[model samples]
Each structure stands twice: as structure tokens, then as C-alpha cells.
Target: MAKIVVALGGNALGKSPEEQLELVKSTSKSLVALIQKGHEVVISHGNGPQVGSINLGLNFAADHEQGPSFPFAECGAMSQAYIGYHLQQSLQNELHDLGIDKPVVTLVTQTLVDKEDEAFANPTKPIGLFYDKETADKVSEEKNYTFVEDSGRGYRRVVPSPQPIEIIEQTSIETLINAGNLVISGGGGGIPVYKDNNGDLHGVDAVIDKDKSSALLAANLKSEQLIILTAVDYIYINFGKDNQEVLTEVAVDEMKKYIDEDQFAKGSMLPKVEASLQFIENNPEGKVIITSLEKLDDALEGKVGTVIKK
Candidate 1:
């Protein structure tokens, strides 16, 4: 059986809780199909929209005297718990219906980041709700929050997007995976944390790219395959242009050259591509699968998606 780490993209989730649960029902079916075929799967997902909405709601409540203030890290934990709950429930039901004996578990994981990572000095990741300029300035002044005007949509809170150096609970995660458990973990690049002088971990206000975290986890777990589900069915060069070309199977050397070309967009396919590179670099024997969630069958059959390998 192949040990696979499936990193779900934003398309796997919905904007609201009710809708997200419904979407995961279908996602579970696809995942269970892999399990039935004798492949061990580990699931991880993006929480960009979910975490932002959660942080916004909680802070609003706290401001209204309805609850205690929640830091971004706490909100990250909350997002992981609830998302894992939904994924766990759906996977259990799906496996049960299929008469599979595998159990699903979600770990509220933490990722360690460098305290002096240059990203800390430059907080570029935008999170939480968008506010009017006046409101943003007021909040910035009162709460010491950084606000950036987001393409005229409105001003939004920005946080550091640091690199994930290590997965703190990797040993536990590997243990669970070894026991044939369907593990969901490293949610939203994990709650970013830093170690102090005494080696104690402290939570911080930052966002680590989920794609990078997924790659890190897969490499650490030593999985044979890392499947990244994005919105596109395949990686394309000159995307959205007349001369665009779809990449089917790319060797590590060729992929490195393609990565150097300005074909992939930074905010979208670039991170996914970069993460795939990291996985391949770290685990030379392993390969990566990148495609849309909608193309699961074809991707699994090697009829679609971009396969990166050494």
C-alpha cells in the first residue's frame, strides 16, 4: 500500500459552516475510494477563508463584551478543531457505509517558525475582515493592528507569513498513520509558534502558507506521494493565454527550469508548485501529484494532473 499525503486546496471547503460540511461529504467519498484501493491517506487542508472569518467573529464578540479576546493563534486552533471535527465525522460515516474499518482522527498541530524570520518584519499576509479606511485606521491606532488597503475592496488586517520550519507533533502524527488511521492534520499551516530562550513555545500572530506546511509534513512523514488538489485540472504554462500548455509528467530537472519561468502566478499556482518542488527535493524517491479536486479519478489513474518526480 502506498502512503499518501493528500493536501486539499481551498476549493475543498466552503465559505460557511453548513456549506463546508456538505462539501466534505463528497470529499470523503473520494478519499475513501483511495482507502478502499489499499492506499493509506493523510489529509490536510487550507483554512484561509475559515480562519479569517473565525478570527473576525471572535474579536467582534470580544469587542462587544460578549467573550474573551482571541488571538490569531487561538483562532487558528479553533479553526483546526472545528474543521477536523467536520472532516473526521464525514470520513467516519463514509468509511462505515463502505464497510471499511479505518478510523479517522484530526490533530491540532503546531508548526515552529524562526523568531527572526524576515517575514516577521514584513507582515504581508492579509487576514480577517475588511474594514473601511476610517475604521481600519481607528482599529490600527487602538489595537496596534496593521491594516493594508486591499485593492480598493477595503482595508484588511495583515500578518506575517513565515516559513514552517518543523512540525512539532510529527512523531505523534506518524504513529497514528502507522496504525492505519486516516489522519487529518497540519490544518492552515498549523498554529505558528516560536521557541523562546528556555525552549518554551509561544504562539504568535502569523500565517504560514498551507501548501508549504503540507509539503513539510509529507516529507517528514516520508510518504511516497503527496497529492496537492488545486482548482486547475493540471499545471499550465502561459496560463489563461492563447499559447498555454498543460504539463502532464515533469522530471525534477525540467520542473526546476519551468519554475524559473514566470508562468505560475504567485498568489495561486506558484505556492503549490514551489511546495511540490520542496517535497521532491527532500524525498527523492517520492513523487507529487498536482491537480484539481474535481479530477480525482483521472489524477489517480495517471490520466491527468502534473506528476513531478526525480
Candidate 2:
């Protein structure tokens, strides 16, 4: 049995609460399979859409005098609880059905980020509900927000995506895992927090890439493997094109070259590959698999997916 940190993709989790529950029901089966195979699983997941929806609803309510105002960081915190509850419920149901005695727990994890990180100067991550140009401008004016037209879908508020340096709740996570519990931590890349001069932690108005945080969590736990379960079956060069080619096994140096060539999309696969590189660099003996949740079984058997290693 090996210690593995698995980062579940946000897209795979579904966009709405109702859909998320249904999707996670199926997701729980795959995860329990890993447990059946004797892997110690530490689960992490992205909350981009969930957090954005929470923030947007909060803002809308506040604007309409229906609810009190809340900060984006608090919205991130709410999202962690919201998503975690669903996952915990679904995982528990599946485990009970299989007569598995493992306890499933969701920790409201916090990740530390550098306040002086260059990412703060450039806000590239988009969030919240999309709006028409006029409405976007109006909301931007009222709320003093930054909006960018997202791939012609509509305008969306953008936020800084800082890198995660450490997982604050790692000790607790380790304890849970060592006690034979399946733990879910590092939600929404850990509510993006920073330490003040007084060494007090405060939430930052930013998003930390979940993949990066998952890698950090894996490194912190000294996990033997990092499995990123995404929508893609395999990482491919020139993805969605006629010249596309799947990468079955990638060495650190080779992946770095591809990254330097800008072969991956900045908003998509790039972060996953970069995170894979980071985890491999930190834990040279460990390996990372990038594959869809549906193909997780095959991927574990080395029949499908891209595997990154030292």
C-alpha cells in the first residue's frame, strides 16, 4: 500500500449543488476502489465555480439588502464547507454500502501564500457569474472590481492566483490519515491565507491554484503518489488537434522543455503539468498520474493516462 494524494477536478464535481451530489456519488466508488487496493488516500479538490457562485450570491444579496456583506475569502470558506459536506455524505454512503469501516472526514484546510508574490500584481483567474459588457461595467463601477471578457462567454471578475507554499492543517491531515481515515483537505487551494508581521494568519483576496496546493499537500505528507483526476483521459501535446499525441510517460526534464515551449494552455493543463513537475521535484521518488476520474482504474494499471516521474 502507498500513500497517495488525489486532487479532484472542479469541472468533474459539477457546476451546481444538485449536480455535484449526483456526480460525487459515482466519484466515491472510484475513490473507495483505491482504498480497496490498500492506498492511503488524502483527497484535495478545486472550488473555483463553487466559491465564485457563493461570492456572487452574497454580493447580489448584499446589493439588494437581503443579506449581509461578506468578503471573498469568507465565501471561499463557505464553499469549502458546502462542497465538503456533499463529498463527506456521498463517500460515507458508498463506504457503508460496501461495509467499509474507514472514516471519511473533510477538513477546512488553510494554505499559506507569500503576500509579496508577483501574482498579486497580476489578476488572471476569472470567477463569478458572467455578464454582458454594460452590466459588467456597471457592477465593476459599483463594486470596484476588475472584469475581463472570458473567451467570449461574457465578462467575469478576475482575481490573483498566488502560489501555495504550505498547508497549514497538514499535521491534522497526517494524523487523520495515519488513523486509517480518508481525509479531504486543501479545499479551494485552502482559502488563500497569508501570515501577518505578528504571525497571525489572514485570508487573502485571491485564488491559489488547487493543483499547486495539492502538490504542496502531497509533499507535506510525503505521499508516494499524486493523482490528479481531471476530465482528460491523457495529457496530450496539441490537444484537440489532428497533430495531438498523448504523453504516456514523461521525465522531469522533458516536461520542463514542453512547458518552456508553451505547449500547454495557461488556463488549463499548464497548471496541472507544472504542479506535477513541482511534486516530482519535491519528492523525486514519487510519481504523478494525470487522467480522468473515469479512467482512474486503467491509469493505476498503467494502461491509460500520462505518468510523470523523476
Candidate 3:
């Protein structure tokens, strides 16, 4: 059986609480199918919508004096725990229904990042709810927050997206997987942290790309395959253009060529491909599968999606 680390995109977990729970139920079912097929699965998921919601809630509450405000790291932790809760419950239920006796667990994971990472100097990762130009301008002026128009979807708060240097809970996660339990960790890029001058760890107001962190996790765990479930069935070059083409299979060198040519969007498929390359570089024998959650089974069967190898 191949050990796989599945990285779920933010879209796989819906935009709201109700939708997220329902979607995760379906996601769990799909995951259990993989288990039935003899794949040892470990899950990692994005929290773009969830953490954004939390940050917006906190901002609103603070603005209205309804509650005290918390830091970004705390908000990230909240997203991780709640999302993990939903996954644990749904996966356990699905496993039980399939007559598979296994424990589903989640760790409140933390990822170490460089204190002086260049990303901090230029915040680019968008988070929080979208706001109209007027509201966005007002918030920016009053709160000193950075808001950027995201793909013409309205302005959103952007934060530093640092690279994940290490997974603090790597040992525990490996132990759980080794013990035959399905594990979920590294939610919202594992709560970005950095080391202080005294060599103490401190939480930072930053986001880490989920796929990037998942690649690091998969490499650290020595997993043979890193399956990244996104909203698309395959990675495409010239994504929205008429000549756009889907790549069914790609090599690391070819992917790097496309990346150098700026074929992928920065905050979208680009990071996913970069993560895939990272994993493939670390484990030359490993494979990275990129596909939509709905087409997971077909992708696994080599009928759909894109596969990247060394």
C-alpha cells in the first residue's frame, strides 16, 4: 500500500460553516474510498475562507466593541481546530459506515518560518471577507490594514505569506500514521510561527501557503505520493486563454520551465505546482497528483487529472 498525503484546497471545504460541514462529509466519503483501496491516507487542508471569516468576525466584533480583539495567530488556531473537528467527526463516521475500524485524529499543528523571510516585507496572500472600494478604503485608513482587489472579486485584506520551514508536530503526526490511524494536520498552513532573538518561538501575523506546507509535511513523512485536490481536474497552461492546454503528465524539469515562463497564476495553480516540484525534488521516486476532489477516484485510477514525477 502506498502512503499518501492528501492536500485539500479551500474550495473543497466550503465557504461557510454549514456548507463546510456538508462538504467535508462528502470529502470524508471520498477519502474513505481511498482507504478501502489500500492507501494509507493523511489529510491536510486549506483555510482561506475559514480563517478569513474568523478574521473578519474578530474585526467586526472589535469595531462594534462587542468583544475584545485577538491576534491573527489566535484566529488561525481557531480555524484549524474547528476545521479539524469537522474532518475528524466526518471521517470517523464515514469510516464506521464502511466498517473500517480506525481512529481519525487532528493535531493543532505549528509550522516554523524564517523570521526574516522576504514575504514579510511584501504581503501578498489575501484573506478575510471582500469589501467594497469605499469600505475597503475606510478600513485601510482606520486600521492600517492592507487591502487588495483579488481577481476582481472585491478588495480583501492581504497578509504576509511566509514559507514554512518546519512542521513542529511532524513527529506526532508520523506516530499517528504509523499507528494505523488517519491523521489530519497542517490546517491553514500550520499556524505560522518564527523564532525570536532569544531562540523562543513566537506567533506571527502571517499566512503560509497550504500546498507548500503540505509538500513539506509529505516530504518529512516520507510519503510516496502527494495528492493535491483543487477545484480543477488538471493543471493548465495559459489557464483562461483560448490556447490553454491541460497537462495530463509532466516532469519536474518541464514544470520548472513553465513556472519560469510564468504560465501559472501566482496565488493559484502556481503554488500548487511549486509544492509538487518541492516534493518531487525531495523524494525522486515520489509522485504528485493534482485534481479536483470530485475526480479523486478517477485520478487515482490514472483516468484524469495531472500527475507530476521526477
Candidate 4:
């Protein structure tokens, strides 16, 4: 059996409960196919839109009502649990329907980050939604949040995006994987936190890229393959124009060259590509697959998806 780490995209689980439920049902259909093929899977996922909405709603409530504002990490934890719940329940039912008795568990993972990480010096990672310059400035002043112009598309709040240094629950995850269990963990990039000098853990007000975190977990677990699900069926060069080209299989060296040329957008496909390259570099024999969720089965069969190797 192949050990694969699948990273679910942010939009896969919508903000609303009804919408998320439907999306999970559709996505689990393909994911179950892999389990049926005797592959043990550990899934990681992004919670951008969901957590953004949660934080926004909380901030709004705190402003109008007498409610207290929740910290960003707490909001991220909320997203991880609910999103993991939807995925776990949906995948469990799908597995049972397929007569696969493998139990699925959800872990609220805490990924370790460096307190002195350079990313903390410059918070360029955008979170939540975009607002007009005036509104953004007002919110930044009122809430003491950081604001930056995102690609000249008005202004948005940017936060530190720390790199994952370690997975605090990695031992438990490894045990579950060894026991023949399917696990869903590291949601929202595992609630970015850091250890103090005394070895105490505390949450930070930053978000870690889920794709990057997935690569870190895959490497830690020594998974044979990493699958990153996104909106595109294939990774493209010269995206969004008549000169767009689809890539089949790429090596690490060639990918680095493209990255050097700035072929991918910073907030979108670039992080995913970099994450794939990191996984390929760390696991020399392992492969990374980038494709849409609908074509996962075909991708696994070598019929589709952009596969990157070392």
C-alpha cells in the first residue's frame, strides 16, 4: 500500500455549513477511491476563506455587541475542527458505503514556528478580505492591524506567515498511520504556534501556508507521495493568456528556473509550486501531484495531473 499525503484546497470546504457538506460529499467520492486502492492517506487542508469569514464575523460582533473578540489562532482552531469534522464524517460514510472499515480520525494539530523567524519582521501575508484604502486604514488604526496594498488591488490586512518548524502532534499522527488508520490533520496549517525558552507553547497571530505545512508533514512522515488539490487541472506556464502552456512532468531544477522567472503568482500558484518543490527536494524518491479534485483518480492512474519529481 502506498502512503500518500493529500492537501485539500481552501475553497473545497466553503464557509456555510450546507455548502461545505455538499462539497465534502463530492470530494470524498474521489478520495475514497484511493483508500479502496489500499493506500493509507493522511490529509492536510487549508482554511483561508472559512477562517477569514469567522474572524471577520467575530470582529464585527465585538464591535457592535458586548462580546469579546477572539484571537486569530482561536478562530483558526475553530475552522480546523469544523472543517475536519465535515471531512471526517463525509469520508467515513463514503468508506463505509464502499465496505472499507478503515476508521478516520481528526487531529487538532499545532505546528511549531520559530519565535525569531524573519517572517515576523515583515508581515506580508494577506488574510481575510480586501477593503478600500480609507476603510483599510481606518480598520488598521482602530483594530491595530497591519494593512498593505495587495498587488495594487486596494488594501488588505497582512499578517506574518511563519514557516512550520515542527509538528507538535507528529508522534501521535505517526502512531495512527502505523496502526492502519486514515487521519485528517494539520488543518489551517496546524494553527501556527511557537515554543518559548521554557518549552511552553503559545499561539501566534500568523498564518502558515497550508501547502508548505503539508510538505513539512509529508517529509516528517516520509510519505511516498504528496498530492495538492487546487482549482486548476494542470500547472500552467504563462498563465491567464493565449500563451499558456501545460506542463506534464517537471524536475526540481527546471521548476526552480521557472520560479526564478516569476511564472507563478505569489499568493496563488507560486506557494503551491514551491511547496511541491520542497517536498520533492526533501523526499528525493517521492513525487508531488498538482491537479483538481475531480480528476484525482485519473491523476493517480498517471492519466492526468502535473507530476513533479526530483
Candidate 5:
């Protein structure tokens, strides 16, 4: 049996409570298939929209009712627990229906970051909602939040996006996986944080890319493959134009060339590609499967998605 780390993209869950649960019902079918095939799977997911919405609501409530604003780490923890709950419940039910008895649980995970990481000095990751220029300026002054114009889609509050250095609970995660338990942890990049000189852990106000963190976990776990599910079934060149072309398989050397050409969007595809590179570099015999959720099985079968290898 193969050990696989499946890094789910944003659709692992949805934005709303009810909608997210419903979506998981559909996703669970595919996940169950992987388990039935005897693959030891660990799950990590993205929380860009969900965490942003939670942070926005917390700020709005605090603004009107005098309640304290939710801290960034708290928002991330919320996303992890709830999203994991939905996934755990859905997957467990599907397993039961398949006559497979296995326990699935969600663990609130933490990722260690350097306190002096340079990204903290300049926050550039867009989060929360987009707002008009005038409203953005007002929020910047009143709330003291950084706002950056995102293409033509108004402005959003950008936070420091730090690199995930370590998974604090990796041992527990590995133990669970080794026992054939499906573990879901590292939600929203494992709640970015740092340790002080006194050894006390403190949460930082930053977002870590989920795919990047997943790659780190995959490397540490020494998994044979890192499967990243996104919106597209395959990586593309000149995306959205008439000249667009799909990439079926890309060697490490060739991926560097495309990266230099700026083929991937920085806000999205670029990080995914970069993460894939890191995983392949560490595990030379391992490979990365980048594809959409619907085509996961095909990607595994080498019939679809872009395979990145060293």
C-alpha cells in the first residue's frame, strides 16, 4: 500500500456551514475509494475563503458590539476545527457505509515559524473581502489594516505570508497514520506561530500557504507522493487565452524554465508549483500530482493532471 498525502484545495469544504457539509458528502466518495484501495492517506486543506469570512465577521461584530476582535490564529483554529469536523464526519460515514471500520479525526495543528522571518516585516498576502478604493482607505486608517488592490477586483487586507518550518504535532500525526487511521490536520497551514526564548509558543498574525505547508508535511512524513487538488485538472501555459496548452508531465528541469516564463499566477498556481518542486527535490524518487478534485483517480493512474518529478 502506498502512503499518500492529499492536499485538498479550497473546495475541500465550502464557505457556508450547510454548503460545506453538503460538498463533503460528494468528496467523501472519492476519499473512501483511496482508503479501500489500502492507501494510507493524510489530509490537509486550504482555508482562504473560510478563514477570511470568519475574520471579517469577527471584526464586524467587534466594531458594533464592543466585543474584542478575534485574533488571526484564533480564526485559523476555528477554520481547522470546523472544517476538520465536517470532513471527519463525512468520511467516517462513508467508510461505515462501505463496511469499512476505521476512525477518522481532525487535529488542531500548529506550525512553527521563525519570529524574525522577513515576511513579517512586509505583509503582502491578500485576505478577507475586497472593497472599493475609498472604503479601503477608510478601513486602512480606522482599522489599521494593510489593503492592497487585487488586479481589478477592489482591495483586500494583506497579511504576512510566512513559510511553514515545522509541524508541531507531526509525531502524533504519523502515529495515527501508521495505525491505519485517516488523519486530517494542518488546516490553513497549521495555524502559523512562533516560539519565544522562554519556549512559550505565540501565534503570529500571518497566513501560510496551505499547499506549501502540505508539501512540508509530505516531506517530513516521507510520503511517496503529494497530490494537490485545485480547480484545474492540469497545469496550463498561457492560461485563458487562445494559445493555452495543457501540461501533462513536467520534469524538474523543465518546470524551472516555465516558472521563469511566469506561466503560473503568483496568487494561485505559482505557490502550488513551488511546493511541488520542494517535495520532489527532497524525495527524489517521489512525485507530485497536480490536478482537480474530480480527476484525482485519473491523476493517480497517470491518465490526467500534471506530474512533476525530479
Candidate 6:
């Protein structure tokens, strides 16, 4: 059985807590199926909506002076715990129903990033709830937060999207996986961190792309496949256009060419493809499968989605 790292998109998780739990129940079934197929599973998930909700709640509390101010990193950790909690409970129950006994654990992971990354100078990753122009402007002015209109869906707080240099809990994660456990780690890009002048690790107010972080994690673990579950069934070129084409199978170099041509959208399919390439670069024999959660089984069986290989 192959060891697989599955990177789940935040969009796949519903917006509200109730919705998230229900969606995760379904997600757990899919993961259990993989386990039944004899594959070892390690899950890493995006936390855009969850962390945004936390940040919004913390911002509201801070605005009202209801409690101590919570930093972005703290909010990330909170998101990770809540999300992992849901996954752990759901997956465990699903495993029990399927009569497959296995231990599932979540690690509040930390990912090291470069302090000199250019993204730090220009924060572009958007988070938190969307707000109208007036509210957005007020928050930006009062809190010195950078706001950007996201796809005309109102304004959102933007932060740096840094590259992950290392997974701090890589050894622990490996140990868990080696022990035949279903591991979930690196939620919200593992709490973005950087080394300070004293060579001490410090949590930074930044967001790392989940796909990129997952790729790094999978490569470090020497996984044979990196499965990225998103909202789309397959990677498409000329997306949204009438002439849109679906790519069922793509070579790593060919995918890079499409990226150079800007075939994918930033903050979406682009990063997924980039992460796939990153993992393949680190592990030449590795492959990446990009598909929707519903199509995961089909994708694994070569029935659907995009597959990138060296």
C-alpha cells in the first residue's frame, strides 16, 4: 500500500460550523475508503473560511474590548484544533462503522518560512469575512489592515502568502504514520513561522498556501502520491470559456508550460499545480492527483481528474 498525503481545499469544507461538520462526515467516508484499500492516509487541509471566521470573531471581541487581543497565529492554532477535532471525530466514527480499527490523531503543526520572502512585502492572501466598502475602509483605517476587493465579493483582509521552508513536526508526523495511524497535520499551513535574529522560531502574522505546504509535507515524508481535493473535477485550460479543455493527464514539464502561459487562476488552481510540481521535483517517482472530493475514487482509478507525473 502506498502512503498518500491528501490536501483538502477550504472551499470543500462548508462555510458554517454545522455545514462543516456535515461535510466532514462525508469526507470521512472517503478517507476511510482509502484506508480500506490498504493505503496509509495523511490529511492536511486548508482553513481559509474557518480561520476567517475566527479572525472575525476575535476582531469583534477586540473591538468591543471583551477579552485579550488574539494574534493571527493564535487564531490559526484555534482553527487547526477545531477543524482537526471535527475530522478526528468524524473519521473515527466512520472507521468504526466500517469495522476497521485505527488510531487517528491531529498535530498542531508549525511550518518554517523565510523572513525575506517577497510575499511579506506585499501581502496578497485574503482572509476573514467579506465587508462592504464602508466597513472595509473603516477596518483598514482603524486596524491598519490591508483590504482588497476579492472577485467583487466585497473586501477582505489580506496577508502575506509565504512559502513553507520546512515542516517543524515532520518527525512526529512520520512517527505517527509509521505506526499505522491516520494522521492529520498542517492545518492552515501549519501556523506560519520564521527564525528571528537570535535563531529562535517566532510565529508570524502570515498565511501560507495549504497546497504548497502539503506538497512539502508529502515530499518530506517520501509519499508516493500527493492527492489534492478541490472543487473542480479536473484541471481545465481556458476555464470559464466556451473552448475550455479538460486535462486528464499531464506531464510535469507540460503543466509548467501551462502555468507560464497563465492558464490557471492565482490563489486557486495555480497553487495546486505549483504544489504538484514542487512535490514531483522533490520526489521524481511521485505523482499528484488533482480532483474534486466526490471524484477522488474515480481519480485514483484513472476515471477522472488531472494527474501530473514526471
Model 5: per-residue Cα lDDT over 88-162, one tens digit each: 999999999999989998989999988788989988666766689999999899979888876445787888888
> Candidate 2 — worst ten consecutive residues by lDDT sum?
149-158
Q: Residue 300: error of model 4 in Å?
A: 1.8
RMSD of each: 3.2, 2.2, 1.7, 2.4, 2.1, 1.9
Per-residue lDDT of 110 in model 4: 94
TM-score (C-alpha, index-matched) for candidate 2 = 0.92
Better of 2 and 6 by TM-score: 6
> For candidate 2, lDDT tens digit of each residue in 204-300?
8887888999999898888899999877898888776789899999899999999998888665588899999999889999999999877877888
Q: For residues 1-310, what per-residue lDDT tens digits would candidate 1 score against the true structure? A: 8889998875357667898899788878999999888888899987766788888788789899999888778888988998899999999999999888888899999999998999989886666666899999998999898888654457877788798999999999989987878999999889999999999999998877788999999998888999998667899887767898999999988877877887675545777888988998999999999988778778999899999999
| Residue lDDT tens for model 3, 112-216 | 999789999998787767789999999899889988876546888888999999998899998888898899999988999988889788899888999999999
Which candidate achieves the best TM-score against the true structure?
A: 3
TM-score for each candidate, following the candidate numbering = 0.88, 0.92, 0.94, 0.91, 0.92, 0.93
Q: Which scores higher on TM-score, 4 or 6? A: 6
Off by over 4 Å in 4: 129-157
Each candidate structure's count of clashing pairs: 0, 0, 0, 0, 0, 0
Using TM-score as the measure, name the better of candidate 3 and candidate 6: 3
Model 3 clash pairs are none
Cα-lDDT of candidate 2: 0.86
Candidate 5: RMSD to truth:
2.1
lDDT of 2 at 220: 82
Cα miss at 225, model 3 (Å)?
0.6
